[model samples]
Target: LQKACQSQENNRAGLGADKKEWIRTEDILERLEKVSDDRIYRVKDALRLGVPVNSVKKLTNIDPWYLMQIKELVKLENELMKFNIPEDIPEDFFRTLKVHGYSDAQIAWLMRVEEKDVTRQRKKLDIRRTYKMVDTCAAEFEAKTPYFYSTFDTENESIPSDRKKIVVLGSGPNRIGQGIEFDYCCVHGVKAAKEAGYEAIMINCNPETVSTDFDIADKLYFEPIYWEHIEEILELEKPEGVIVQLGGQTALKLAEKIVNAGYNIIGSSFDAMDLAEDRGRFSDLLKNENIPYPRYGVAEDVDEALRIANEVSYPVLVRPSYVLGGQRMRIVINDEELERHVLSIFKHMPDNRVLIDQFLERAKEAEVDAIFDGEELLIMGIMEHIEPAGIHSGDSSAVLPTYSLSEQAIETMKKYTAQLAKALNIKGLINIQFAIKDDHVYVIEANPRASRTTPFIAKAYQVPFLNIATHVMLGSKKIKDFEFEKKLEGYAIKVPVFSFNKFPNVDKQLGPEMKSTGEAIRFIDDLNDPFFRKLDSERSMYLSR
Candidate 1:
């Protein structure tokens, strides 16, 4: 829609009159049906291109009322092109824009200005967002649930409470890389907050999540996990602190924004997060701490990426920084693949920095989930990946109480986890990945927030690790205060479940990028038991099927 709007503006400036391109209605229907998320935008685009409403409706079978609604939004966008930011715009104009669900980022794009500039203008004009309660009853009886959604109206139903509160942001949606695992962490964190005598407020957009249930948190805000929505919620609630460490990368990306807005992050500071996320800075930290890591280098362009790959040798793992689920990650075995991967990455994310590291093939992979209270660290559990280092952790089958690692390697990983937690000042949960080759331990990466394995480990060991970490973040408990059992009696395996039938033609091979949509767990008294072997065989056969 934005592209179509820009094209219309260009045509007006260059041709001096609106010209319509004759397109078939069948093509419009094809675009609408194939691109599910952009159907409404496609309608707006078709209308902007002068596709008649009668033709569109006759082919697409969409109601005319809906088409008119989209037409209004398109008209609004055309009017928006005439104004600039912070000047020549009436204060009341934003109220209408907000009523039409125009985010500050969208307005900024239309006005060809930075998003922050639009934000500053909105603040200057005091055109803040208001909240409306999601009432099940239509005022026949008073609704007791505190669920709310944002709007540009005058009356606000979500009144601030005097009691101290902590805001927990939920992972936005369920997808291949991030799924219900992070939602498990968020739900546990909210429960812990209420148990610690503070009202818990949850901000999430997914209605399918347990955290979005009306009774899960003291107050629920069913809003997008974007910075603008989160900032508005914080502006109204003024919570004592915000917990971002349990919500996965979706919430973790907003750490700097929350800090810059003068709100307190309940756990590790933004600098710590940056230190862990920034490839060069993290490598420097590991070098200073005498930690073993794969040889790596950062790059900004194709030439630099190829140079790093040559230095690191062949079979290098390349990925963009500050990404979760190993999105756009690959193992390039030669210069040709390196150039191709770097070009593809830059084409999609032009401003992103690429991190090229030596790929450890046939190396055993393990992960550790631990917690820290600024002074002491507790290792929750250690999971050994059934597959090797190349497969993304989320897509790999992992066995808890590590079935294959030697005692020495396990101790070394635990020591490294503690050292990193203390060095990074982690107050809540931390997940660290390790690669073992020739009896040597190397740190692959570190995540300051909860991992997808958090819930799996908790269920297998019957431990409340998330609860403990939440208390640690709230400063109400320490690692020494809890009686944590690090060792388990039996073996537990987490097998990745894929929905291949739903997505036709997708490659079934697991690699650096995650592909599994969900997971299933299996437990047994012995790893060599017949039932365990049978289940393992079934899991192995799934990939081929």
Candidate 2:
């Protein structure tokens, strides 16, 4: 060590005994090993203490590749500190990426982590990045970006003087066909804004969608929906008001955040949204309103989950407390499959928080889309699912202006939808899914924000849903009192499109889980000859519309 220092000093100007040749001294190696966490820390100190770099390397022999790993680790930590991580990452995300032909360096590059620091926070956040789950990667990273100034404003943006007011919130493409639906909302929202002689402003990240095509809104900003980015949009483009409930949960969630951040929101409150999502709360609400739902229980651990699973008689549905669309949901018919799928997800999530319920089969499913302004509820229309209730409505075939409805069932459905809407005090579009078994109506789910079916309803009914929702956000009341463009012609059927053939080995069957690439809506009133919703060999379907 002393000799190493002498060589470094010799290269410099003349020096005294302080730079004299020296030998390795007692306890230096032991002292270093006892305190230094890694070679880089030791090297930094040695260089600061005037010891030669070569001598440090010669003594430690730490691999250059390993040093690079350490640096990457530090960089990744700094990055994560800026943003939050999502509750879900592909199971075995890193390992799966590796198996699917990604090198360690490549995996590290994509994850922005050091090869050395890829340790799982829990096995749940393990390295998995299947094509299906890839889009979720940016959510957490985007969420963590440090907020900017001017994102917080206690005052809401006022309406325009020269034009009508339309505020658009975008839902970026996540898994399934959700992205296109948002585009649908943006297109109609802007059109509605134009019809009402108002300016339209949009916030979205996806440039690939039609919403980002520039002509959709007067002002379009490609910003992350993080609190910081959204708050920035709210501050800069203070429109008459904000729209949240039209773009699905991602947009709605951000809207809730905006409300929490002290900005004026144009739709339902965050508390109302929470009631619509929580299974226990929702079920209780339904019961209180005399709406029937399947018997269910919340499970906290394996023992309780298993017990509930047994009571539900093998076939049961399991879903997380808060999810966009059944991301981890599944139907289990046996103990083995139950244990395989249930254990991992339940173990990671809050115990006794999962909705474990008996699976209802052979139930005719239907949907009701409506509009409200916190005072009165207006039923937009009722539609029946082409497939049974088990298939995700997004993936199921649906007919607008339901066919098999009994007058009693129709009246009951309308009343329940209105009741739920009024009780929630929501001020925008709301969709409710119900299943009729033995002539009893059961409320399955409710979306305070837009459902996948919103675009279909708007296009079919020729209603400016975006404009109406926008007005509701601005304190307008009574959708019935306002005139709506009558566009319902004949009948419409919405058929789902899939890319399963292009991506092999993906599970195709649906339940609470959603898995459709896109959809097509067909219009025809000739109920005489039924068409079989044609699917080309490529999994793309062409509907009449």
What is candidate 1's lDDT per residue for 78-117, written digit by digit as tens? 8888997645567777778767777676777678788788
Q: Which prediction has the highest TM-score against the true structure?
A: 1
TM-score of each: 0.91, 0.66
User: For residues 1-545, could you state the per-residue lDDT of candidate 2 as single tens digits?
Assistant: 21122112112111111122123433343444443423334443344345544554557776555444334433433343443332233444433333333323223343455533433332245332211112223575633211122211233232224554556777754456365887777666656655556667776666677876655666565544444345545644556666777667667766556777576666777778888887778888888888778888777666777788888675788776666656677777877776666677755553426678777777888998888887777677788876766777777778887766788988889888989998877778789989888788888888887777877887888876666765665554356658866587677888878888977876665666777878888887755435633321222222100
Clashes (N, CA, C under 3 Å) per candidate: 0, 18
* Model 2 ranges with Cα > 4 A deviation: 1-167, 190-200, 235-241, 311-313, 346-353, 485-489, 532-545
How many Å off is the CA of 544 in candidate 2? 27
Overlapping backbone residue pairs in candidate 1 total 0
Off by over 4 Å in 1: 1-43, 54-61, 138-140, 484-488, 531-545
